[model samples]
Target: MKTEKPISEGIMDSLQMKTSFKDFNSLKNEADTLYLKFQRMGFIESELLELKKENDSSYLADFSLGKKFSFLKVFYSSEDFTKKELQQISSEVDETYFILSFESIPLSLKKLTAIRNQKGNAFARVKLTDFEKDENENLSATLFIDNGNVRTVDSIVVKGYEKFPRSFLKYYAGVRKGKIFNQKKLVAQNENLNGLGFVSAVKPPEALFRKDSTTVYFYLEKQNNNLFDGILGFANDEETQKLTFNGYLNLELNNNLNYGEQLLINYKADGKEQVNFRTKLTLPYLFSTPFGLSGELKIFKRDSTFITTEQQIRATYQIDPRSTVYVGYKGYESSNLLDEAIAGTPIDDFKSQFFIAGGSYIKPQNRKLFPVKNAILLDVGIGSRKKDGKSEGQLGVETTLNNIFNLNYRNSIFIQNQTSVLFSESYLVNELFRFGGINSIRGFNENSIDASLFSLINTEYRYQFNDGIYVHSIIDLGYFENETISIKQNLYSFGFGLGLNTKAGLFKFNVANGNAQDSDFSFSNTKIHISISSKF
Candidate 1:
């Protein structure tokens, strides 16, 4: 017989052939599946193939595929892309895809395969090497794709916020190093920074990718917080039947000496020879905690009406961005100087000490000017008045709403109602609520109506033009009741005005008509109101 090939050698050859075929088939099947998937996705010119030698243990695959142009075509021209369009597309694509590796092609492909197997077809990677335009000027890119791992944040860098502590910024970022970078969280942090009132502008966080890590950078622009402002205007006092010149001056130092502290000195004078002065200091953070401290001293003196002075110290704790609770101690002293005719009775001086507690909820609009959107304030206090040696309690609530329509036309609606009640053995002129004037029942004299219980509502509709100027119409209703004094009155007023807002303050001119009874309405009793007040 012819020398037969050894049986063992034949068996070895058969096993090698089977293993090689299996490896080649595995790679070919995977490539073919990807190719067909891309073709169905409208990548008409795509191909995938494997090369393997009969005796080699490894195989090499070369893939040539067309990049999906549908998304690009929707936003860009086929020949080229505008800068903004390109940036938008790049951002969208980066958010959608994660690149696992840019070096070592085999490892990348292997990792991609594992990811694809685990994630079912939701993952993809496209590496473009060249671009070619077809007869229709449609662009196509050579692509190599595989599943990839998402990039994690390596570090965060903050720039252009020199006044703010780095720790503060990091705390607001609300992220740790080496965590998966999230675009939504970054956007939230940016918005939070903008709302702090210290920053004028904030750029979107930028991600710099390196290998598998992403470095995020935050850019900020700070606003000027140190200012000195003044306001000048005129007012009419119906009680005195005299016209008065009114003016205010304010000095502010904010975020300079302390991180976010503010110091304010304000002085106001009116033509009635009345003067009011106040000094206040605010510390936004107390000992690095979320609590705040504020101290104020106020002095008010009118020639023949009253002389009042108050010292207050308060501590506030922030519950969140929109809420706060505060407690304070107030020492007040007042001397009533009204004549018997004006007061309707003889009144004595009073001294009081009080403990006050309150809370506020403010929903701020996201705008540079006129930031208040909605707010509520409630305060309750219990005290002892030394003049009468009696216990006294007071409650006050105020609410405001603005921008009701949420329209870009700059239309706004505002409503404010305040009620103050006192519990005491006997009512004193200083303790009674006074209603009238521009701040209360417009078209009436300041402090013209005084009673033990008083309530008032002010409603306004405002329309803004250009250059921070606005026109507004207002309605005011007020009621006063005093069973002990047997005095009851209802007052109503309607007015229209124009105002100009400046960085320093707001200046307004108003004309109003008031009537104590429904039948007493006439333009002959019109009142003129003028005022200017500092913003800070």
Candidate 2:
């Protein structure tokens, strides 16, 4: 080779010739490798190599780089493929577009073979046959493709958790019997199943192939995701002039019966004598189908002012493994517990019924105090409310988003945004939405505020020391409209919290103080929250 040759830099780079070799066989093997490399680059297969030994430690070689070949025209040979099979390939991919590197026939052929393999032709073979060479140094040929036997999923076998719900297999894992068998896609199906909180994979996913079908195997084990959690808040009561207890308790059970169902019970109290309690049950994959049902019952008592009872039921359809959409009905009935009605106060009893629709998506993340994961929940309802036998139209909407962004492995930012709205001409204190406390807005008592419309957002910067412990700074901002009194205001809170994850459970503690934008902050407004979540 000479420095002043017609070969371009790319051609020279493509020739990975070594400077020296230990033996004649070593030198010959390198020459053989280069032959295949150049042939893959459309170089003539007839290129010649000449070798000469000059001394004990030196040798010289010359390569006759022949003219490169380009395609005159290419054709896909579907003569042996069934019409149905051809239609399947055409629907998924354009068989004609795979001949991209027309000059490099082998490379193009490799692409064509891979496309077939993905389309259930696991043993397809392709070759350029019936070649006709032209005087211009180009060749025309038919790309004869032999699409081997088509394969489909015959069944799925679970080694460890044989009782796994079949519906979870078809809907959640996206792997169903009789589906197209693509080894590449099947290999990734394990992650979709393992990402679930209710189960874990004990062994690597495996596949067994047969002459006519494919069977995937999963070694799974059930995981306990049930939790019993409690929150304790200490806030000074202005009327009592003493610190009072207010918080919430939650018990959630999941997949207990292996039906992929969930049960939750929650209760909250705000030392102001307002107590809220709710219980919900969700049964997914009804009759081994994508449909599910969820029901909820809620009771709220505003300390002798009013007691409200609400019931809701939703019919849900699993959209994918991680998402679901639901349509539901919500009914509310309220009665003033007060002995006498107070004038100018919207504290009377009322009944409201709503038709609701919503959807939700959840994705799990690393098991850490401040894991970088994502979730979203939202719903809207249009219905009516009756007060003193007077009926009126009402609309309600609610949405919440929780997400975490990781700046690095140990550092992250967690943000949550929530909005709730209830629109009606007339207002009732008992029917307005309530959001406060450590969960929604720190430094405020649970269920302390009543609003017709409100938007709240929280941003927390966190540093995880390890899997168990993390520290964070909390910042919250919100705007609310209290339609009862026609007053609107902005609220803000600044705080710091620490979270600990242990074998026993997870614990979080926070110290925060907040106030409305129109008011002055007070150290006496400080609130402390401590919570623990234990899972079984």
The collision pairs in model 2 are none
lDDT of each: 0.63, 0.79
lDDT string for model 1 (1-536, tens) is 01122224642343232223465567566556655554544444656644444445655545465444442222222222234433432433232232222123234344434433333222345345464566886754443445355566688787787556443354333445765666655666666666656564467878777765678888877776665666768777879878776877778777775377788897777666577689999886566566789999988776677878889999998776667889999888998777654645535688878888888877656554456667777776777777766555544333332234345657777777767666666666655655678777688876566677777788778787855788889798877776456777787889898888775566788999988855567888799987655543
The superposed Cα distance between candidate 1 and the true structure at residue 533, in angstroms, equals 6.2
Best-fitting candidate, scored by lDDT? 2
Per-residue lDDT value at 322 in model 2: 72
Residue-pair clashes per candidate: 0, 0
lDDT of 1 at 140: 46
Report the Cα RMSD per candidate: 16.5, 5.3
What does candidate 2's lDDT look like per residue over 1-536, in tens digits? 32223768887787877868888999877776776666666664435356667788876666666666643355554454443544433332244422234444555466657767777777889887776667876665666878878878888898888787778878877788888777776655665666656887776677788765688788889888899987769898787688766877899998889887899999888667888889999988899889989999999988769999999999999998778899989999999888887876779878999999999997755454542278899999999999888999999999999998889977988999999999898889899998888889998877788999999999899898888799999899999999888899999999999998878789899988988988898998888988888989
State in Å the error of residue 165, model 2. 2.0
TM-scores, in order shown? 0.60, 0.80
